[model samples]
Target: MDYQIARHNMVENQVRANKVTDPLVIAAMEEVPRELFLPESKKGVAYVDEDISIGNGRYAIEPMVIARMMQIAEIETTDVALVIGAGFGYSSALLSRVAETVVAIESDATMVEKAEKILQDNNYDNVIVVEGDVVAGYPKQSPYNVIMFDGAVAEVPEAILAQLAEGGRLLAVVREAHKVGVARLYEREHGVIGHRDLFDANVPYLPGFEPVESFVF
Candidate 1:
């Protein structure tokens, strides 16, 4: 299969058609062989418009959604990023192309192993895979200039927000209901984090990042 041509179509059709105009993001998505990150059975649909499940309840978010989120991030060339729920590390791999360094956090051991292997084989030395709690963020590399959550979350945790460097940007899909979610960008200035909705998207929930339910009787 000619993945380069297919990648061009993905960027031009699915991504740009959906309003993702950032050149860096487009280039990264174009360069990365997304099919390499998927299981053999799922590689055929890597660039399709839907999320491809990489197993363990994790899904590689749709290309347009991921591209749009990266566009909204306004990634800086010197920024260091953290990707929560890195999944198959596709997002992290894309991020490594934009950020100076990327620390990808994954809670699933199997997923982490797969992500690490692929990232290494592809020579993504700028990306480091870390196994730990996704909700907590990876503080060892705290105060990151960019932080991105790979899946939908009920709410962005304070712990994660606390890791954002001053003037840093953090993006996530905030799911308000079963089928409703909004992609939001949170930027910290003078130690205060301000947020605004970027777009509407619904992706698989990153386990442990969900909001705690209240009991009312």
Candidate 2:
């Protein structure tokens, strides 16, 4: 499959056609070899308009969703980023192109190892893959300029929000009742975090980010 051509079409059709106007994002999507991040069995469908599952409860979060998230974050060249659930490191590779440094956190040790190796083999020097609890947010690298959750979550942990630097931003798809979800962009300004819903999205939930069970008597 002419992967380059497929990448181009994904950017032009799925991303740009959906209103993602960031040139850098368009370029990153066009440049990144998304097939490399998927298992051999899934590579053929890398550029398709659906989320590709890489097993173990993780999905690559469709290309357009990623493009829109990056567009909303407004990543700057000087920014430091944290990617939660960095499955296969595809998103981290993209962020490495836009941010000064990227810390990608994964709870699964095997995924951490695999993603780190792939990103390094591909020359994503600015990204650091770490093994950690997804909800914990790597505090050692706290105060990130941008933070992104690769999949949907029921709520953004307060600790993770605290890790955002002043004027920093974060993005995620908040899954609500009846399986509905809203993509939201959150910004920290003067120590307060404010968010605005951007669009509708539906993706696999990041493991351990499920909503707390309510008591029903």
Candidate 3:
């Protein structure tokens, strides 16, 4: 496959026309080989504008959703970023360039292994892929400048919010009822005080992020 052409098409058709105009994000997408991150069986479909299934109950977010969330996060060159539900390390690779350091958290052991190999092969030194549950978040690298849920969540748990630094920001596609929208949440000294929905998207559901179930007597 002509990777360059596919990347260009992704920038033009999926990102630009869809309103993700940040130059840094576009450049990152161009730099990272999305196909390399996906499973060998699905490499050809990497940039096809649809979410690809990564093993262990996780799915990579679509190009449009990734681009849009990255653009909305307004990541700075010096910012520290955290990516939850990092399936094949696609989002982690894309974020490495925009943020100073990227901490990618994946729950599935096999997927983490695959992602780690891919990131190392690409020489992305700024990223660290670790296995962990999404609900707990990665506290070892707390106080992230930008926290991104790379998949859709039923609700943002307070545990994750506690990891964000003061004035840090988080972006995620929140699925409320049946509707879904990308939300940008800001953390302040007191707490995660404010957040606003940016746009609607069809993102994959994140495992273990739903509200706790109670016994119905």
Question: If scored against the real structure, what TM-score would every candidate get?
Answer: 0.96, 0.97, 0.92
Candidate 3 clash pair list: none
Residue 212 lDDT in candidate 1: 71
Q: Encode model 1's per-residue lDDT on 1-217: one tens digit a residue.
A: 7788888999899998998889999899899989988889998887888888888778888888888988888899899999999888899999999999999999899999999999999999999999998978999989999999888899998999999999999999999645589999999999899999988888878878666776779
lDDT tens readout by residue for model 2, 57-107: 889989899999999899999999999998899999998899999999999
The TM-score obtained by model 2 is 0.97
lDDT of each: 0.89, 0.92, 0.83
Model 2, C-alpha of 2: deviation from truth (Å): 1.1
* Per-residue error (Å), model 1, residue 193: 0.6
Instruction: Give lDDT tens digits, candidate 3, residues 1-217.
Output: 8988988898899888898889999899878888888778988887898888876667878888888888878899999999988788889999998999999998888888988988998899999998988788899989888999987888888888878887788888887655655555555556645887778776777887653555768
Ordered by TM-score, highest first, the candidates read: 2, 1, 3
Clashes of each: 0, 0, 0
Candidate 3: misplaced stretches above 4 Å? Answer: 181-184, 187-192, 210-217
Give the root-mean-square deviation of each candidate in angstroms.
1.3, 1.0, 2.0
